[model samples]
Target: MSTDASGGEATGVPVTVTADAAREALSLLEGEGMDTDVSGLRLFVQQGGCAGLSYGMRFDTEPEEDDQVTEQHGLRVFVDPASMNYVGGAKLDYESGLQAAGFHVENPNVESECGCGESFRT
Candidate 1:
């Protein structure tokens, strides 16, 4: 695993972050006093949820040695190699409405999702 941005160049970016999502994430990071230049959002897939796989995200201080780092809309995103396999070609977006307001991932690799819409199978 290279510490450089080669992971993105090699496999392409696993996910794309929308303007809204980037804005929200940057704001959250600022609130936490994390430097925007060194801190970023970590997006990954974990085994769980009713569909056997669930999406997980959090603020990471920096990318790991094996993490694929990509930047868009003034935000940096980190994705590990294993998780990249399942989330490749996914888009991260933020929605705000009376019914719902949160970050959502539009993943092209999804084959099916649970009824509650919390988990998916690829």
Candidate 2:
């Protein structure tokens, strides 16, 4: 839940959500480019995909009691305790370009991503 620059906490285990990355996630939600009335973004990890783990996300109006709430650049994000381990030391970003567009993750745990980058293995 706590981390410093370079992503290493006191225990040496990286706590995801860099301050800069957290800020980017917020801009994607309420920024001029977003098209949803999302209250906050939820980050989760699921099994399946070419790799063994997959990333899933959605907008939620309310967060669960056990969810961890972190904010960056005024944008709030809800991370479930279960998914925290997998997504720890990761970042949330929005990619917009002629070929690729939408939300992307800069996950440190990720070993490799599928061709489309829709899935990854840790």
Each model's lDDT comes to 0.87, 0.65
Overall local distance difference test of candidate 2: 0.65
| Model 2, runs deviating above 4 Å | 1-38
Pick the lDDT winner.
1
Can you write out model 1's per-residue Cα lDDT over 3-122, one digit (the tens) per residue?
335543546445888999999999999999999988999999999999999999999998887788878887888988899999878999999999998899999999999998789999
Alpha-carbon shift of residue 103 in model 1 (angstroms): 0.6
Find the 10 residues in a row with the least total lDDT in model 2. 3-12
Instruction: Find the 10 residues in a row with the least total lDDT in model 1.
Output: 1-10
Instruction: Give per-model TM-scores.
Output: 0.91, 0.69
How many clashes would you count in candidate 2?
1
Model 2 TM-score, 2 decimals: 0.69
- Candidate 2 residue pairs that clash: 16-89
